[model samples]
Target: MTVVIGFEGSANKIGIGIIRDGEVLSNPRRTYITPPGQGFLPSETARHHRAVILTVLQEALEQAGLKPADVDCVAYTKGPGMGAPLVTVALVARTVAQLWGKPLLGVNHCIGHIEMGRLITHADNPTVLYVSGGNTQVIAYSERRYRIFGETIDIAVGNCLDRFARVIKISNDPSPGYNIEQMAKKGSQYVELPYTVKGMDVSFSGILSYIEEAAHKMLESGQCTAEDLCFSLQETLFSMLVEITERAMAHCGSQEVLIVGGQLFVIKSCRFFFSNLTIFLFSKSVEFHRFCIDNGAMIAQAGWEMFRSGHVTELPDSWITQR
Candidate 1:
């Protein structure tokens, strides 16, 4: 069986995973969480990765019951992420590959998500809705490449949620977005936030600014609770996402829709939309959700795809893209 070990340190999270012929053998990760109202900087995130990367890598190997000799290939996320963190991961991946005498591969972060989603769900030719702190995209597979049909024009939906969470001083222990999702469950009022969807593209900067100001003014004046603002933001942003996703699906004539990324809370936010569209939840279990998030197994899976397709990265070309 083809065995691949993958490294991912794209943002605040660092992870390593091992996969053997489409099956995940081990996946371990650590998050670098900042205090409430504070966001993680690239330098700090990279330092965090540097501190714990080797430990996590050991854990992945032990959990997978594999030795360095058994690994045939080494893989890592190559870009569209924070610069320092991406460089940190690339350095480790390159070192490991040379040490083990294995071929090295650089995988695209977005393509990793799509590959893992397809592998786990076994969905053929489904339209993909990828939402995360850094990216929001509606994609479809065509001509051997994942094509972006719709996307966020300004800020990503998850970034919007995170910033709003900071504005309201929500805890960032696990993530600001998760805290916002929890608070939104208790919300009953709709504060009528701005809804901006242009054709297949969505914009969140305007709505985020509007809500941030409204939250400060209304919460101080006893006009609305934090939960109400969270609810309103989730509803408005998710509706925009749903709108563009539906448009992409219709345009692609796809019957299956796969949602992948850190923000799977879109399910609770847009459950009603599912009734009209054929949506695949992948799985409702916690493992499924974890797999959907940023992780190394996805990168390994994508690397396995590329390796089988006759792709490899030379030592000199394994650079990262920090877009």
Candidate 2:
């Protein structure tokens, strides 16, 4: 019977949400989108979060039919995200907690995604693939901690896709990854790209470098289209992801797989391509879209879980982490 309000701005998106008893009451978020050939800077992203946070907070409260005084706790992402953005959201959370005379809780950004996915799918314990702009990991829960079975060695898959989109000058209206997915649908040829998987981990920097060179050559020689490049890149990278995920599943002995984060939408076309894997695509669920990204509802839910488990941050102990 706890009512928690969460704020999340760990990256480019700013979100506000309310949750009660493991159920999301309201989740509202906004992303800071840049133009073609541009990447989001931390300072600019933080500014966007600061600008729209109050409005989003108001909307979330209204949607939840609750007032600030009704909230029992305030939660916010503590880290593993951009410093400026994380600090911005943390500051807001601290302010809200103080103003409302509510307890404050700091949540891990990655765990927030996992907990929200599990809450939505009701999968007892599933192997998780957490893919986002800044993170890529295959995780499993054991002994109360989420252990990383496989992860990226270098750049994250989503970051690589975003950089590739910049090379091709794709619009960032919705997202670069979404644009790449759409363009990849038109591709008929599978241009070979490097696939680097080291043991349980994968690497994407080399692939990104190779694709940048290929893109330049294609543009110069008029031999290949951007769509073809997008298609080939998606095929190669997604195959690597599936392969590693399968290996983790086999090792962990889990039949259900939960996928979370913004990049999940990019690989929706290949969802059924994995054989024998009962993928509980959390992002596909109608009510779970906001939780898929770095949103406040996930933070609130995770924080509430921690709170119920008797975990809370004292006023002087509030902090943020980059790892």
**TM-score, each model?**
0.94, 0.93
Worst 10 residues of 2 by lDDT: 282-291
User: Lowest-lDDT window of 10 residues in candidate 1?
Assistant: 282-291
For candidate 1, what is the lDDT?
0.85
lDDT of 2 at 219: 65
Summarize candidate 2's per-residue lDDT along 1-323 as a digit string, tens digits: 99988888988889988999988899999999998999999999999988999999999999999998889899999988999999999998999899889899999999988888788878778888788999989899999889999999988989999999999899887888888988888988888889898988999999999999889888678777888998899888878887788788779867667778766344554443343233522222212112266778989989989888888898787899988
Clashing pairs in 2: none
Instruction: Work out how many backbone clashes candidate 1 has.
Output: 0
What are the RMSDs of all candidates, in order? 3.5, 3.6
Q: Which stretches of candidate 1 lie over 4 Å from their true place?
A: 264-291
